[model samples]
Target: MEVLQMEVLQMMTPIEFWRAGFVFWTRAAEAQLEFASRWICAVGLSQRAAQTAAQKATIEALRAASVVPLAPNAISTPVPKRAARKAPRLAASRCRPTAH
Candidate 1:
């Protein structure tokens, strides 16, 4: 990126506008705008959105994913039961227990 910028600066003859860096700067500006929009949305403009169409859609999607409902009323099919745990019985009376 630095090499491209240097090449662009070298090509600027001071008689005309440099075209190459213009493209690069435009893309960088667009990226900064997107980053700022995301930060604003995250900081709660999502609920008070009086902005772009894309921002409104993003807020709606956020709200939809946030809503949660409690326990299910019924199971469509029965779940299989797990096997019972076996007791860990030991014949330890035949030997002395270890001193912990």
Candidate 2:
């Protein structure tokens, strides 16, 4: 079982590993947000204040997990527009008319 698990892990690409890390930290951040919300609400904080506090706590957790929040003007390059998708070509047999 351990060898199987190791083999599976070894098969994971770098992007897959990064995605796994991202999902793990995203959940952790969400849990932090919930905790902050409950704590602030228990303290009789205003709704807006509670939200702000929760957001800050979530950001801190994300930062600790190495997920850096980017500013609006932090992007160095303009994002390129996605190219239009092309329809798949039909197989010759499928395209041909069948005899009745």
Candidate 3:
């Protein structure tokens, strides 16, 4: 295959070579455009699907919330107060150094 391609490349005229390169590049450009368009379309579709899913989830959450009953004072529970901290006191005799 390599020998055959080398022979064909040797036989090709300068114009033919240029033409082949041009055709290959053009095809590549078209393929890239097609891939980009498909990728963009996929992204758009995914975004729309996510939005729809989020909306459905929100609606379901709202329905569930409505079905659940709230207890009285549930919204106004009193927070417990914390007692103030005090420093520990050592007796004078305890604080004094013991005799050696």
Candidate 4:
């Protein structure tokens, strides 16, 4: 490119050379601005995702500590009868049968 630019340089007047340099730098600045805008957008998306995850985790942790289960059935079903829990049982007899 330098070799081609040297050939073009010989044909261009001093004023034309300055104008070409100005145009090249202007295009470079525009390209840099576009890249920066895209990078900032990507960073913003990831930041929002992290914030959403953090909020969900905090809410779940609070619910676990309080042991609250507020659902649609919270008002009617559990009001009269509380939710049943599974109780452990002990073996009363051996596995083999001794008599009929």
Indicate which candidate wins on lDDT. 2
Candidate 4 residue lDDT tens string, 1-100: 9999899999999999877765665555545545554555567756555555444443444344343444634433645667799786646674465696
> Candidate 4 at residue 33, lDDT?
48
List pairs with backbone clashes in candidate 3: none
Put down candidate 1 lDDT per residue, 1-100, tens digits, no spaces: 9999889777877544434444555555555556657777777676345246344444443334332231232222466699999988778787677899
lDDT of 2 by residue, 1-100 (tens): 9999899889999899888889999998998898889999999999899999898777767767876676533344587789999999999878978799
Model 2 clash tally, residue pairs:
0
Best of the candidates, TM-score: 2
Q: Which pairs clash in model 4?
A: none
Better of 1 and 2 by TM-score: 2
User: What residue runs in model 1 are displaced by over 4 Å at the alpha carbon?
Assistant: 1-17, 47-100
- Summed backbone clashes in each candidate are 0, 0, 0, 0
Instruction: Supply candidate 2's per-residue lDDT for 31.
Output: 86
- The lDDT-based order of candidates, best leading, equals 2, 3, 4, 1
Indicate the TM-score of model 4.
0.39
| Candidate 3 TM-score over all chains jointly | 0.42
Superposed on all Cα atoms, the candidates' RMSDs to the truth, in angstroms, are: 16.7, 15.9, 23.0, 23.0
For model 1, what is the alpha-carbon lDDT of residue 98? 86
